[model samples]
Target: MSHTFRRRFAALVLALSLLTLPARALTAQEAGQLLQDYYIDDVSQEVLAQPTIDAMLSALGDHYTTYFTADEYAAFLASMEDVQLTGIGVKMQASENGPVVVEVLAGSPALEAGLQAGDLITAVDGVSTAGLEMGAVSALIQGQEGTQVTITYLRDGVSAACTLTRSSILVAATSAQLLEDHVGLLTCTTFGHDTYAHFTEALDQFPQADRWIVDLRDNGGGLTQAALDTLSVFTGGGIKCYFMDGSAQLSALEAKREQISSAPLIVLTDGGTASASEIFSAGIRDLKAGLVIGGRTYGKGVAQSVLDQYTNPELFDGDAMKITTVRFYTASGSTTDTVGVIPHLLVSPDLAQEVALLLSAAPPSGGTAGYYRLDLNGSWYISQKAALAQPEVFAQLLAAIPPTAALWQGSGDGWNSVQPQQAAADHSIPFQSRLFSDVEGSPYAQSIQRLAVYGVVLGNGQGSYFPKSSLTRAQLAALLAQALNCTVPTGESLFSDVSMDDSYGLAINAIAKMGLVEGVGNGLFRPDDTVTHEQFFTIMGRLAQRVSLTFQISRQGATQEDLDSDRLSRFAPWSRLSVWLLSSSQLDELDQPVSLLWDDVTRIDPTAPISREEAADLLCAVLERTGILPA
Candidate 1:
């Protein structure tokens, strides 16, 4: 028989072999029906020509969504629930010699059989495993409960054998601790079968904490229901999560808020955090139950589901596939796919110190109702204070902030961020006396004029307005505060570089209170430091999100034209800023980052320190795109 035919025949036979009573024999018709009815997207018609339907599923471009053979499918289902594992309870990796045991779980058959870390499995059932893949080795080791499998291995250069009878093992999924100051720290590694149960138990263990720090730092998410159950521990059962094809709701999962902890919540995340982790972090922010810290989260918003094995035994037996059935969203309807939850404040992952510092930094106070605060490290500050529910004195105090300074919002709970519809006037009154001689009649004049009108200019009070001067971090803070309308807070600055009495202190405090920006490095905002194109665009991207003008680029769209730099689509866990910039632009030219004026712009050096005119022009363009100003 031909190779393709042999593969197909084996697949069909395997499918038929796995079926019980009332199950029909496998055929081409069965494969077609399964793919058509359950796949998240259309299956290739070329599936019939391939060796097996598994090949078609593999072409779907998602490695996590694929066909699992009978053995693998059984293991997968067992892991999803509290189903038993019929193995030695040791995790391992394939090596040149054999499989190296990483860890032998305590009380597992492996541990009972005296398996130790660094032990190498040389063979299974007397078959040499030198070149066998780890999965194949695993399959050989696992069997029906009470069955005996002879495991041959090498320990300390010694060869030995152990006949282990497999039994079902329950894998626990979460860990917790009562941190200093009665703060609870709970970390969920995966949203697996036992995660929700373990999480509930962890909460019960640390019931005395005044605040809870949920750590999803390196979690490579699992079950959506697991994410929901965990989040409900904080949100006091409402809508844990839901899916909408478009405007129509497909499913709305409700959970009663268990009121696990009434204290303010904190979540820690990093690049490795994804899927279910992303769901929990986003839901926390959307539901206004907590704040997030650390770097941007991994933006994976798709949901998947495996076909019911019991209901479709003929098709599901010895075969399985996870379909990307729906896109997940936050409770506020925010989609966190390519654009993740940008933490209200970005902090280093050194949890001990960061948690202490965050707790020490008191939130905004003395603000009247209805005003916006400088939030999220100043990456997003309220731009329109008058729109808040506070009194005029509060708005007047915050609105009077120097262009290079910011203040906490004088009103309302400091949760949601606000983007001002109108930029404040006389913001740069500190530099009101300057008259720039370099910017007359230039194409950038119109934008520069409006920027100065709003007091975002970085000019000294002297006769010269040095438009060519490199923009400073302090200047950017003040400008953002003025444009965004962040009100006054007299609290100490979060960064070591600025102080409450310093010239830029209010602005620094203003933005930090709002979680709009963070230190340039090492917890220092570096108020005197110059801004670069990369940093500039990163800031602009956050601003774009605040006004709800952020773009969502499809990965499988019409291929974009090759750009100046080859850095467009290659970004991921490492270079999130690039990804955010490219994905949030409606036009391809934004990636090149050339000036809006097609001409007069030379190389767009992302690392180069930007000039005042350049800053004004770019900010103008962003405002126009966000509809705060005319395009």
Candidate 2:
């Protein structure tokens, strides 16, 4: 047969084959089945029952898994390849006159048009380039490939003009240069198709450097295989990472390559570093191959598999599914999913490289820094400097510790763990316990006494604690203000019903300003209004958000679905998620016997008024759970 005729005949046969594909491969149903089979978490029956693919994916609650249209899939594929830019390629910088060409790329339209370095472009088309920023000039210069652009330039104070067609140019995925003290700074923008080769080439360009810093700041991820291959350059041939599938089965990804360099390594990351970038960082850290110095990375430990018509002709027509198949972990088996890879020395993103360079040269000296080593879920050595520098981070680490757990202190490798009470006793610290006579035999006695000691709850002047009385809105505000360290308002109250002379006025205004509460419509503070159980939980949830307090939801605790379908639904729409969060959190147990419905994670009377005793217990439980009040 003739070649053209054969090609047409082959296309016809393929079209016919697609028309006769099996019925089992139809759209939503088959895609749902595939999702259930491949998803990294258990797919609920409710999710699969959705009639359309979009609804199904949304119900699955896995944000990474997505459906992409044909055009979107094409763009995604292009992004995974080498970075491409379309322009009459010439690198330029801003100058007093106009953009001054620094270099003309070989094989580019600019070079072909005879544009040279030191030539300043005075205008584009007929528009003046004066006072336009470099970015503005670049936007004007870059356009659709094959489009024509005219530039007016001054060569040694003489005017000239050139018309050029824009074309696609491939930019290097990685670049490297040597810094002072034999330090190499290698920057990688993407884990694209050519990342491994480009990374190696960059490394090879600076082989004389003894220390290296791989900057992965603002790098979102690309191809997984490319990241693994690039990481192998440092770790050599071995198991680089582990992945856990839906069935909890673990698999290791190994690379069979020899180590490229044995020099000390440092990784720089920021909040934008995700997925493949995180994989590279985790591998280096887990292998003890490098020290990461930057803000916490964007936690994206899941891996996705793209399914398109090319991969499965029978299942897909033009649309595709980017399904999350597994959760990847470091070689040490820890995943950077929600909690990102913590840097060895955390610093601001701009300062991270500077700090890394300093540490690369020599260890930090000349500080009365003490280290607090704690073994919560993992081993961590927190320095006094780190704690003071990032107090919120230090508080979070401390919160991870069980309240009664001992903390260790010492310098370098020598350490001694000291219990809270023991350390206090050894230092002869004066510890006082407050007693309330009225609550001496009550179930909430201990909680009331504890809150009294923390100054969160008070008695009726004569030492008579009214534990069973209903908690008032004003009372609750004062209690929260004290616990949260909210400053007492100095100005006039915002509510018409409240006055500066009122006892709870300052606390009410302070919390209101902080958005913890709202006036009972029409400027009424309603200080005497009863605080309900649901309202209290909602406030606790809001408090958690205000402080950025993240909780580890207990698997055994109630889920949001359960709360929505149960009596808890009586809560306001804005309060449900918060109430669920508080109910599901693994909070410290209360000393007293008063049964708060939230403690059971079920059977809460949402509209019932909360009592003083229950309010105190709940508040104290939150404080202890967040490490605000020691056990």
Candidate 3:
């Protein structure tokens, strides 16, 4: 008989033998025989696939363990290497007290679900975790995508139940915001694939900001390539990082010449920062691109390469191996392995004092009515203020608006002229008039008018401005760039597939220039894709950095009280952005709550193209309220 036939016969006999054995009497060998009988065949490929099987067997502990063919192995590797993973975005610390949320990535599932740092894990999935090890708690929380897990936690002596859905949580290594006084703040959570893109987007969103704060506190680490990419944003060119495998030194990663922003930068870090985070922080610090703040970082400088076991399941069982093969060194040739990168300034955590500090500085003791402070230069506020300040400026701003709109209208024609207003006997203006009219008397009217006048929304060349078109990713970027008066250099498109004629081309280019968006595999910017609420919040946070930067600049020469009151609180994400932008913002001070107009909220058809009008109105409203635009 042929070898294949013999192997098949052996597998069949083994299966028959297992069927005859009593289930209760089965030994480990018997169970192995049963699995082998039903699952394996002795092909050459299968022989080579044994190591993977061994790894999987070793890794399994009562959970599901299945063998993967070569093709299956490749697919599994892809999923593991994916920048996003299914889990809540949080890092746990095993302390004498309990499992505490040490860090929470911005705009993550955990952050959205209202989880916070200092929150103690009391129970997970209904099991009491009173004395559970941090590793156990982490294992309980991590699971397959789409799975739901319940977590019970204590915050300030109050217990709360949070149900979170597991989705691919992309660890945002970098986030940028334009503060109130044109100061930019970029927060690096940990280095990851999307770090550079997101960082650049933040910078592009507020290119003109005078100063910046790059927050790297508690950023553990990931992907060396991502760390280098982030450093490239600040450095001019060449050798961001190098790898050392023992005494063997490899070529260094060189920075590309694409400079995003050169604003004076301040980086925040703590003892929890490690590995790639150290690489980025140290690089920028060494280059004098930014000043480090907070405490020292967690020193982890080893480079690990993942070896997936899919084809040869028997050799590795079924689990993958991540072997540390290299050690990373800074540009200054310092090893950040055990000796962490220390910050330039040391700001310890003071929850009560910080809250009091922010509250006391709260904008001029305004009325309790929800009021948004405007920063005059931000895209949203700039458009709104310019329309309110000079109606003619609105006309000028409208004139420069790009022709990327899906629908267009002839120049010099007002929207009202094209779409006749239905006579409204009630005090409420007709929807069409409300959308297109540039009359600036009422604040509400001014808010509505500024959005229209900014060319964020145009009348269907036929005169009807559809204020309710579902916002798409492309449309939002375009509107934001227009409002900010952002300039996109004419260069070869970074995306391999996006054409100049594509509607999203300019917006994609602008976002890429600012560093808010990145192309997916092989340089493809999926421009027309609809953005989710989380994605939108991430972008808004980036824009909000400018407002924070502005506050920092305004208080540059001020006293500690002035700095604490005006500078910190004004741009404080805890005080301003999160609280003002997200509903969850009400839960914590950092939860910058955003209140949207009823119409605006309804118009966010999450799956459709976000009309230019919606983007314009939302950006304008946010900027106006944040005090980034002059009220």
Candidate 4:
């Protein structure tokens, strides 16, 4: 409906409901009259037998079709579009005095203005929140962007007022990250206003990756325009969906020409996928651009349009409702309402690891795959040339790879994983440098290079190692965990400050469980905090004990345990070493826990923040002392 028509209709409805009939009482006759005038269902008031509003709606059997009061309507619209309120970024929770700031997002005006979590907002814009609910206070805080909203908050029972300019703050609905085999993993939580733009930017970040994975699992969906815009990224431009409105008027939404990539794609879906996400999945599957994997999606083929009633206060009294007025179908004319689009390949969400493995190793649904490895159980169809051209990675793979690991290639029924014994014979495979470009002349470059090849360290995933930067607690934990080949514990995290879902949780908890490192307190592993030189050395010493390795520079070769032949690094890369603390003469001196306070290596400011190069140098010295590196 046009805006003008909706406004006039709303005014009439409001005026008729309030003035023509006693709406305050909402008698059966008046309710029946309103339903007859505005309800989309076919039931007539004459057939309702003077039924009450609830009875009439119940008889119609359209659960989604209902009435709303002023507050309910406002809440409904807020839930749908979130109202795009301009306010400082702080989520509020109900408190006796007012609303308490439960969270303060980083880089937000609230945080920038020194607002902290747990603050009680007693007033907003000079209006006291003494008798207001959290919702009422939240409404008072919202205003136009660039307008100053003054807030009075109490911390420790001391009140202070601050004025902050409101701005639009949105979390990216789409995120991009590089995964194993250099695949660009892009997951869209929902199609929001800026989701398409964020997705396009994410695609540009991994131009080197040849394949991509689009994870749409658990996405409930969002604006239809966002879905159409996102489809354009993959298809260049195409008819996305056809819509049939209440008046039987049909329209098609075609994507604009702003294609991102045509890479071999794999999509993940689950029961939460609906509406906009369903449209996206249909396009990818129908066009053969990607294979949809995981459980069946949520079927929602109908769209709801707002029934605006803010136009007339006399009739609707500032209340409104929504109706499912449009039915949508995919470009292929497939409508998923009660029956979702069954995946081309049905896979369970719990087997996500296997799905990821297949996408990274198995032949893509259509195109040829480059890198793959067969399991130790002797898989079938073992034939395909490895297309991986990364010399450094290949060399590292050949350095000490397990005997059964093999790379695969080709597509569909022609796929296979092979050991590629011929590639191993090509020793002249130029060793590609993986070090930071600026670290060419740094003395620690070779140390960082070999560690990266061994997968013990990594750059920012954008080719920058930031050699001189301070290593975070998480970074050091990952380094030690990887170096010792520690298997991450699958149980719940031991730290309240970190979650198992985060990248650092497993490594940090693994070392903590091994008694190599202790949390700073309160079950909080501050992963972002800087690692101190003293603390790191102490942890490394404990890791050596946990891993059953003893570093001693007695001018002696590595022991049988340290040089296990089955281990790729069993053979000593160095003949001898002269590290001070590990030297036989000095080893017994700092064996005590308290010795770190006076040890020559860390006697001065033991807790000082350590840089990556310094940490690498220390690691290299340990490696040299333990005969893992050549001197």
TM-score of each: 0.46, 0.49, 0.35, 0.40
lDDT by residue (1-631, candidate 2, tens digit) is 1233222222211111133433333478987887766676778899999999888988886778988765566676666565579999787878777799966765899999999989999999878899999999999999999999999999998999999999997755666667774788887878877888876786778777877889999888887777888888888988887666565556678877778987778889888899999889878876777767676778787877766665556676655677787677766555565446666544567667665554454222453236555443233344555454543444333322333334776545566776433433443444222346688666766677666644455567566778888989998888777666554769778999998789999989988987878888999989999998888888876665443223322323546575676645667776776676666443335632332233564556778899887887777666544433433
| Least well predicted 10-residue stretch by lDDT in candidate 1 | 7-16
lDDT of 1 at 341: 62
Question: lDDT score, residue 354, model 3?
Answer: 21
Checking candidate 4 for backbone clashes, the offending pairs are: 14-314, 14-315, 14-316, 15-315, 574-630
Ten contiguous residues with the weakest lDDT in model 2: 8-17
Query: In terms of TM-score, how similar is model 1 to the real structure?
Result: 0.46
Clashes of each: 43, 0, 86, 5
In the range 560-628, model 1's lDDT, one tens digit per residue, is 443223544332222344333433334544464333321222345667797877777777766544333
TM-score of model number 4: 0.40
Give the C-alpha miss distance for residue 357 in model 1, angstroms: 7.5
Best model number under TM-score: 2
lDDT of 3 by residue, 519-618 (tens): 6677777777776544564466555443332222322333445324432343333323332333222212465534543253333333334444445555
Decreasing TM-score order of the candidates? 2, 1, 4, 3
Q: 625 in model 1: Cα distance from truth in Å?
A: 12
TM-score of 3: 0.35
Cα RMSDs, all models: 19.2, 15.1, 28.0, 25.5
Best by lDDT: 2
lDDT of each: 0.59, 0.69, 0.51, 0.60
Residue-by-residue lDDT tens digits, candidate 4, 303-404: 654443344333454455444556676665556553355554444554432354344543344544433443321221211233244443444433322322
lDDT at residue 403 of model 1 (Cα atoms): 28
